[model samples]
Target: MTHTLNQPRNSTKSSSFRVDLQGLRALAVLLVMCYHIWFSKVSGGVDIFLMLSAFFLTSSTARRISRGERPPLITGWLHRFSRLIPQAAVVIVSVVVAAWIILPSTRWLELIDQSKASLFYQQNWYLANHQVDYYAFNTSSASPLQHFWSLSVQGQIFILWPVVLAFSVLIWKLFFSRFNFAWVAGAFFSAVFIGSLAFSINITANNQQVAYFHTGARLWEFALGSLLALALPWLSTLPEKIRRIAGWAGMITIVASGAVLDVQGQFPGFMALIPTMAAALIIAAPATRAWANPSGVLSLKPLVKLGDLSYGMYLWHWPMLVFYLEVSGNQKASFLAGTLLIAASIAASWCTTRFVEKPVIAWQNNLAFPHWMPSTGLKAISQIAVVAIGLGIASLSVTAWENNVEHRRALAASQTATDNPGATAPEDWDPAPAALTLPLATELADEWQTPGNPCAGSNNPDDERIMFCEQGGNFDGSPDLVMLGDSHMQHWSAAAAAAMEESGGSWILVFHPGCRYGSDADRDEAECANFQDAAEEYVADLAPKMVLTTASKTVAAPDEYLRSPGEQETIVDHYAEAIQPFLDAGSQVIAMRDTPRYTYSIPECVDSNPSHLEACDGSAHEALAQINPVQEFLAQHDYGQQVVSLDMTGLLCPEGVCKAVIGNVSTYLDDSHLSKTFVLSAKRQFAEAFKKATGWQ
Candidate 1:
């Protein structure tokens, strides 16, 4: 199961091949499978895979080069990729088909992007750059291809490691032929290990989500394995009893690493050394070690067979689990479902290894297909051609499908706007069972005027106002409405725009992603602190007829709606402080309560639970304060007569339960933000409320 290049005809052979390594591969795959399916944990198994891959590749290549054989660079690359790509290609194709059939169309676009990333071996980069919360399955749906990140990392390393090996080969052949080549390789790998490990620690501490998928952050694990590969000969010289104890202890450490340590949250930082080092220790043990060695357990016939299927299983398991969750509407699978999924993954892995991988590897070895004349020393051109055509067709088809969906949604939105200028739906209308679609997934994106707005990221406190304005009605210049705060405030942009159009006013938007309107440092984002200060000054300067913002902010803690006592008080006090300046400037201030957040996406819930929409509904008491903190603060001590409070919770949580959908429209785009499609329907009601609160009409 350890993926490695084909040894050239003249390469040095091992005393005997290690079947124990194969067993370790099987155990690692099983650990990952179990952790993902049942434990909802990370077993650090992927670290073991990374280490073993590097160990095998480095040790094999080093021994050949040290023995003065030419590094079979061309044949090696072909063998390595051919062994991997064929099986990976099959799995990617199968996953695409399964996703198209089983997953909601809303997720198809993301799946398409992920499929391409996986196929091209850039999935880790894709996930890292996108800031995907790989661990937060409750709030964000797990991507079927998320597990491909490790495979992608390995693929990247496979390509890059060879270059380093080839460089080492050059040095050994050109200058270090008289010296021990192992030391040269060891020094190089040691440098890589130290450098990458330091970076991993720094980046993981700064941004764990990105660090989790960053290839740079994980390079040290592979480097450590390479270092171990250089020392394998010396390691084999250790006493038999010591080797046995090391192997057993290493295996035990790896098994316990997941259960006893916070591996997922802290890796691939220094903590990752636990599993990777353990794997290296096991690999360094001599194959002839006694039964006291853990290799005895690992090299059993059944485990060896499982190891043969490990690569395929690792590729196949996650998508199956994700598809099962999507189809079954379960956030987490039951024991029965998990068992069935594991069985399915194993069966698929066996078929893929037997029918797909073995044949491809054989064909590649035999050179049955002709190579392109120009791209000499590479695998048969036919393999690359087939993969490219397959991936290109799939990517374009999905892109076209997404474009068509977007075109239809845009047409629908335009028609809806024309037909209902006020954007109101019927009172008794309910969400259609099949209403959820791909367009609705990012429906809120168009609701904000921030994209082309001049006000975006305006941090200057003295700009003489009127930078980014979302004008709702024809204005000679005077502003009648202003929207301020973070995304929570921006969520109501559509409704506020509609209200402005109806009430005859120009509205200004001033917001950043995590910025609050108030100047309190504790409650606001440090990065956006200056922007908030500028926004406060700008709002006071404009003194629009009415200022609209939100009192809602997500607490820093998980599953906790109520902020810490100090944060809550600071937020409440800041709200008054924020509005006091606006009130003094004769602008009526209206602070709306934030909508309840849910643990899942509305569309995902609707897709999975078509017959039970109520399953998506959440308790207000759990997701929100019993009473609005702003409303309570205002009631206990009046901020000012000019400051008005609006509770539009009735629009969101009409029956004391925040419904996923209302009036045939999906209520939320994701976990907490209201979908623009749903918000559009409430424009008329919002306009009326605005008129009542501000007496603007």
Candidate 2:
């Protein structure tokens, strides 16, 4: 037992401890880098590392706490955080700077927004809400910081662990002070591991990628290591045979997890148990056992070297892989090239750790603060200072880019020849009178709810409408039921007609791309408002009972061009003001929420990997369980605006997560918008919900 403590790392000829563990790190990192680059698989290397991290940190922590020598939680957190934040900041700030310089104007503003979220460690949520699809690859715009989702999840674990450990030690001291510490830690690991497994399995099935990224469900892996550390005596006593096999077995599990798993395969589910348990076994295996000796394999020098660079390796690899894909256009590549990239990543990571992470980490540790200051307080101030500096730099770069970078690049008019016309997609089409996506049909339902645009005045009343015909007659058949709304209703046209026909009735549906019902753009647009005033007078005369609509969750939707603070606020307030007409009219507002949108579309998914479900996006129900800002907003509308849902709560989400697709069918036509086929399949489900809500069969 004392041998491990006695084994000081030599500059040359690394010990069993160093070689073996570092070797494990190398394997884990290699797997991850390869999977992300060429294998195109869900690499569980990060998961394995996370498990290892929990074990190592927890084990070390228990020893300190047990000796009644515990340091301040905040101090420890900042110490670890310091090791991480600087490099992360560099990557993030660098990405933002590079993006500002390299990306086109249409994406510049969005990149800036993503940078803000990345800095705050909310990239996972940013990606999940904006990019997750059950059957699709996350082909969203490259944010080097997207990899920080793991960092955020880990940071969350770090933030809460110390407090919990302190409490656990206290409780144990009071009741079973002399009782085996290992057992209590074991209990912690077992309970948490089980919970995580349960959660991972359940949520992966349902499509809640964000929740899966939540720290609560992932804490157990780290806790398992803590438990192992507390009970090191039990491990030290184990025979060589078991220890050797376990160590090797753990390595195999991590490799398998990284190389084989896909998006549909539940992670952190039963599948995660393999990597987590393997990690547990590695931590629990003693230095010199007979049968499954950790000494012979894990304690190698090259492995030890990699372990020293492990932190930087983890940070650097993902971004590099992404950058490679970005540069190469995520193409089909050779295994040999992938191997080289992984090697290059390892080399680059090592360099980064040595030059960047190590110096800052060492400096932070060596810094001498005022005698009166608490260590935690000094560390907190330093971290804030670091963050402030990064933010300042990023802000300055963005401002410079905004000034230097050209906007609109000599507009379409300038590009056109005398005979040719510069045009936008859907230029010839007019918005359906009651379509949701069309600006005129549904005045941006919630001004604060959308993104990209802030002014809610872009709808064209004179545009021709593109119809999907949800519940309507065939081309030769007479139009009976006319359904109208944005993409949500348009996608329903094909299915709605089928449902009506199945019911011995028919419908004629008209679809508008962005128009929503019972909403008006009149107040915000001078010309449109006048047009709307006259139209409202007429529409007041022609109300349609069978109405379909949508409200988006993009935050500041409907608002457009949003140039200044006054404009942003005015546009938001103005859109909020637009909801008055729907309340005033006795119009049945079936304000269907906008389907969840992924960061990218299917074409990219197909281009990236033709074989995987990444090519097939989900069912309408799978796309989401709940509505966007519309549902919540409708609850507070002036009048009792009767709003009915597609009953998407449980059916749309299972185990607390919603998917974009299930089985093989495509759920959305664009982003999170569903296709008519999906809407048709959902008829029975939506109908049941609708009937229950309105009591009309």
Candidate 3:
């Protein structure tokens, strides 16, 4: 992703302009644009860019070290970053301003965060931690800055590879003076290649989403390039006929790999070898006129010129595509629109390269400091420091704006708490008017509730599978109440905590995000199955006075018909079997009916359609089954004495419609999860329902 337009200062004539390599860069960028704009798939182009960066970097550093010349570790980084930062800064600032103007207000804070991450070269880690699926193909919801992830990885390696080379040089001079430095470096990189590739394969198999953005998983690709650079001299000795075959083969493979392979799912792993090694072959291939080679096609002037704009084009293309999708309201662009997007991206790239990148590079190269500044390295450092300060100012401004927005949202929530009665309001009650909906769109991300404290002492489950948390009352012994299940149960934690506090009893929360509490054999997901087994075992052994969980699962509207009688029986049978363990332990079961699931995010829908709130409403009859599954299960079984089914359908949906905004509070955070604000507003209702179900004072 980082384009090395200029060779290292120690470059030999052999390292001079290679039209084929430039053309390779152009092809890589073009493939990336084509796949992203039209195909919605990974092209493996960024992997080629990463490998080529290491190819160039290692080629330069190893040459210097071999000649007994000290590598400019400090000044080199300063120079490289100083050249790179100006264009990146311009793109980031432009994206931020554009996002504020064009994107929904709900996305502004997230954009600010990603912009900072991108500017500081930490975007890959940020996205990885968030578990963003790079191949989601949801352009409307995708971040315009997501493509910066690859660039961030490149930036990190640019810093790291140099230190690695410097250390290799030190070891070579001290311990392995008899051995060639390239041999030593190659040996070290070989170990990196093997170890990192193994790790990449393991992690990718376990979690492809995280592996895609993981730096350590990607280190092997760069190491392979380093190895190729070290072996170039030996490779050039091949016959011209063989080199031509390899060159054409590599070029053909690089172009065909994206179309044939599942790059998105399998990359940064062994599958990455296909394109990266193909690139390696091209890099090692001879480009003479004595024999036909891929260079005949790749060395064309227009393609070579496109390579000049590759870096800028990479930066411009994604944002243009994302914004185009947003403005046009299309899932995927038409071929004509995609072509125009590519053209606009190329033009923008040209402008940035011409007006921003070239000027900065020229200024840095021609820097003439005062006599007092003795070292050119110091002048380079000064330039880098100026860029750093500019980035710092921009980051601080964004942080201040984010803080102000959060403060205003918090103040508005507090002021309207009384007006927004939420689920506790009577069906016929008319609420007071408010300026903004409760849990404002800007604050929706924080709507998922948590217990705010992890379980401790005897209350904490020994099994790690149970994501245990504690709230309410003093933790002296076992919890008086236990809440178990997935996120559907998590949303009720606040209300449960309030009830426990009022009753002077402690409660433990045992949750796994998407896993329901039931028989492990019934679940298909291995992790969720394991979590369910552990949670059931932990809760049954602890034997709390009461256990709470979701009694049924709601499907999104349009597919919301009630289950068949046999399906209902099977569902309740699982619940009854799961609940029998708690009943045998002398714990009462409170099975609350699941909340309505919508086809779209409630908060987002409400945010975008505030004037026509009814458009965001859903059919209550369709949202919930005709008969409560829990009630049917109780009637069909003999557990009614201990198992109590609590249905809040009337509270959630009034007049046969499930309104997104109830009593001025945004009911659901996303499509299925209830907003914490709405849940907390329903605390009194929850407490009253608990009293009625248990006959507790």
lDDT of 1 by residue, 1-697 (tens): 2253211111223454576777888899899988889888889999998988898888778767757776665566655665677667777777777776677656777777888888889999999999988776631468888988988998899888888888877787688878788887787888999999999999999999999999999999889889888888888888977877787789899898889888668988889988988887788665753566787788788887787778888888888888888766678888898899888988998897778666665654456434544444345464564445545655665566567657757765654332332224455544433343323543444543342234333323345432344444545444777888777777788778777766556667666765666646534555566666667777787767778888655442242664542243223336766677888888888877666666566777776666787898876655666667766766776566577777677767766777776654677776767767667677777777777766777
In angstroms, the error of model 2 at 9 is: 12
- Score every model by TM-score: 0.81, 0.58, 0.85
Clashing pairs in 1: 430-664, 431-664, 455-468
lDDT of each: 0.72, 0.52, 0.80
By lDDT: ranked, best first: 3, 1, 2
Better of 1 and 2 by lDDT: 1
Highest lDDT among the candidates is held by which one?
3
RMSD of each: 5.5, 17.7, 4.5
lDDT of 3 by residue, 125-197 (tens): 9999999999997744699999999989988998999899988888988999899888999998999999999
Runs in model 1 lying further than 4 Å from the true structure? 1-16, 66-68, 334-336, 365-422, 425-439, 442-444, 448-452, 456-478, 501-504, 512-538, 551-578, 591-600, 605-667, 677-685
Best by TM-score: 3
Model 2 Cα shift for residue 310 (angstroms) = 2.6
